[model samples]
Target: MAKDKTGRLHVTVKTGGKRKLSSKLWLERQLNDPYVARAKREGFRSRAAFKLMEIDDKYRLLKPGLSVVDLGAAPGGWSQIAAKRVQAVEGKGKVVAVDLLEMPEIAGVTFAQLDFLADDAPEKLVAMLGGRADVVMSDMAANTTGHRKTDQLRIIGLVEAAALFATEVLNPGGTFLAKVFQSGADAELLAQLKRDFAAVKHVKPASSRQDSSERYVLATGFRGGALR
Candidate 1:
């Protein structure tokens, strides 16, 4: 009923035997989520903006005029923030966003409706960029099959693909950020990133829901020593 400075609301909802306690609580939480309201007010496509905000605030990414690619940018919340920041610099900047689902337009952003896993996806992205990018970000999560191991593998597969594509498209000193489940990143994925990037760190943003198993991996300073 009331919202505090933290954007948390003490919402009351009657379960009425229609739903489980967890389901009712989750619905109520989403309904009263201040970030949701803030996103609506700020014209963000999803509350995911806060997640990116928290990440950038901590890591100092999203510089002005930087070239960036937003993978799995269906709702375009992360792209929205990136577009604004990158547009602030001279000579213009690029924010190329792609997703399997159609996204409503956001100014200063280029949207592509295509599956990132498609065979020609990397080529299409390269054509759109006309060059390498400074940052590559992915919030892609596979449609969960409810089978823990299967879902983990699916997400890891996507993350791995995104990571490989980043290696192909990112310039020297570029950064890669992607979401991953708590099942932990695959060993080969970590090994590849460590070899290609100067540093890799895992981060959990504060805006992320406490119950969510999602975390982000930030790999920065691409070696680019072998990209040629």
Candidate 2:
């Protein structure tokens, strides 16, 4: 292991017959990422846990006795943070995580393997939560295809769906947070959120890689009722 001038570790990926240049570069980046190291040392499922931690630290979204719905929660990093902050492990609150893929058990989170886009997803989530949620958050991203425009559209589509779901399931005075790319198409989504929530803001947590275009849309103080 070697440390760069900035005191960050520098990892070199040796090229091999089967390894493509892109894969090698990705491996190198992950190897040197401080959050990845910290996640391993701290026992979080993924480095993404820090993104939610930073967001909640600034926004105070997670609290004891709050009901939380985690959409597209895979690998369970965000769910882990929510469960602890909301004291779900102690039975003071609830954390319901939904994803297309199965996740291993987290002490206080109830996992469901279902697509958020499905017709019955909202109702199913409400039933699992046992009522309206205090917070609905998503860290979902569409599978990238290397085409910028197509990728941006896909990202916006998912965030829009997640936002619509939040409005339906969130309680009055609740919060919604979701990841979005820095795409211009987000304007419509922002407009809709502003109408449904008292305040909406864009946040880029330090835990997120600076090179990534990812940003989180945070909407607080839900006005409640059905989507307009």
TM-score of each: 0.87, 0.96
| Runs of candidate 1 exceeding 4 Å displacement | 1-9, 12-26, 88-91, 225-228
> How many pairs of residues collide in each model?
1, 0
- How many angstroms is residue 82 displaced in model 1 relative to the true structure, after the best TM-score fit? 0.6
- Residue 164 error for model 2, in Å? 0.7
CA lDDT for candidate 1: 0.86
Over 96-194, each residue of candidate 2 has an lDDT whose tens digit, in order, gives 999989899999999999987788888888889888899999998889999988988899988899988988888999999999887533778889989
Off by over 4 Å in 2: 183-185, 226-228
**lDDT at 147 for candidate 2?**
97
lDDT by residue (1-228, candidate 1, tens digit) is 776668766777787766898798888877877788889998888999999999998898898878899999988999988888788324478999998788998888999998776777777887888778899999888888879989989999989999988987798999999999895577889889999899998999888887788999899999974332
The root-mean-square deviation over C-alpha atoms between each candidate and the true structure, in angstroms, is 2.9, 1.6
**Model 1: what TM-score?**
0.87
Judged by whole-model lDDT over C-alpha atoms, candidate 2 comes out at 0.91
